[model samples]
Target: MSAAGPLPLVGRRVLVTGIANEASLALPIAQVLRASGAELVCAGLGPTPYHGALSTAAEQYLGGAREAFESTVREHLGADVPELIADVTLDPSLEDLAETLRLRDLQLDGIVHAVAMDRTIRGGAAKPLLQVTREEFLDCMSASAYSLLALVRVLLRAHVLREGASIVALSYLGAERVMSHPYRNIGVAKAALERLVRELAAELGPTFGMRVNAVRFSPWSRSKAGGAIPGLEEAVAHAASRAPLGNADPASLGCEVVHLLRPGLGVTGEVRHVDGGYHVHG
Candidate 1:
């Protein structure tokens, strides 16, 4: 008998970021990636030196978030799966991450950019877009959109990201359309993120054989970030009813991501909708 071929992701090292908790979309994607024979390094949001001074409440919140991230990774991914603290909003933090990976001699094959935040949407309500302040707007853009470019740039400069690396960013339908829910500020950020995917793909593909793509997931309300978005529950229900395949679950989304992350694929600069054909509706 002939020898069997290796698994699609075997020997590939993939970094999955933005795993806030068990319900996070990144969790399932990481799970699928690992199952497909990829080595995983996970990063989550936490306090970084760039923050300077933090109040007691801020400290507590950050500490708690980090602890939860560690616990979740331990429980689901495994205790030995490497975990790193990263605040994508900070360039210093991103540089630190790149340095850490370089020092570890880890050359990444893929990156899952699953980070996003919107201060304009809080306490189960979204501030009117016109009412959003400059700081708030910029913060949203920095964390949700520009972080991809920043992270990739740092990795490329540090030589931590190998040529032909696959980069996937999570997006949503709100990027191009006005959702029934209040997607206001984050929607704009997602739109920018999608644009970054295309622009990066164009630049990176020919120059270094890298691929960049974004996936617009279904109206998910199980994650902490998703549940916090006002009217998302209604949006989820409405989407489930209207979508041809109901609602695409995290597992399906994971599979598609793994497909994109697979090396040697000709696909790039694509914004794929994993929302069960809901995006096709007018």
Candidate 2:
């Protein structure tokens, strides 16, 4: 089919990282963004032909992952939406990704940094900081915290972000608060991330009119990282009860994010909570 003209996100392109499956929050954001007329380009940790982690197992496990995701997204958004691949963890090189998109005539209107990491140190090793390795803790900070800064850096350096661009990163309640031991480094990383979002928003808003923000979600069993958090079920259930509006849907969260990405949305540098009312509860 011939490519259609620009639609809400028309004339705009978005770089969404960390998409895993259809049920993933990123997928829904992609969906809503597409519906709003935005072109799509996805990136992720490797195991896929697109961008992904370099680890053999990650590649093996994530194999065909990007292709499958592209197929699914295209099927839903129609064949016109574009997609791309790149690994965010592979920092310094991330700038090349923007150039890659430029080759396709896609200028970024927004970026979604949904990437995060926790040392799969479950069980005994998942204990308090004393039980965790220095390397593991640093990895968590690098993956979950610095990755956001890295994304903004690459986009800024590449000039891929259009004026008034929106950057959304995910955080959790555990960052400011706490859940348990296994969730340690991630919480610290998130706390750092929340601060980073504000700083970026302050800097970018003045320089480029770009909006930076983080979305804090309650425990949701959609991603592998989330499922690994022990006592997650209880946490989510408690959150649902505390929420004045009851449970929050991933798709709904995506819709809110879509609105934030648009220019003149008048929202930025804020930590938007998609956790129902759980944060308010306690």
Q: How big is the RMSD of model 2?
A: 4.2
Where does candidate 1 stray beyond 4 Å?
1-6
CA error at residue 173 for candidate 2, angstroms: 1.0
Per-structure clash totals for the candidates: 0, 11
TM-score for each predicted model, relative to the true structure = 0.97, 0.86
Query: In model 1, what are the clashing residue pairs, if there are any?
Result: none
- Give the lowest summed-lDDT range of ten residues in model 2: 44-53
Query: Which model scores highest in TM-score?
Result: 1
Task: TM-score for candidate 2, please give it.
Answer: 0.86
Give per-residue CA lDDT, model 2, range 1-282, as digits (tens): 015434456667788887766656677777777777777888765432344336776666556766666666667656766656655666644766767766666778898888887874464345576777888888888888888888788777776778889898888888887674357777888999899999999999988988998888767865666667777767678777778887788877777777678778778889988877677865
**lDDT winner:** 1
Model 1: ten consecutive residues of lowest lDDT = 1-10
> Candidate 1: deviation at residue 124, Å?
0.8
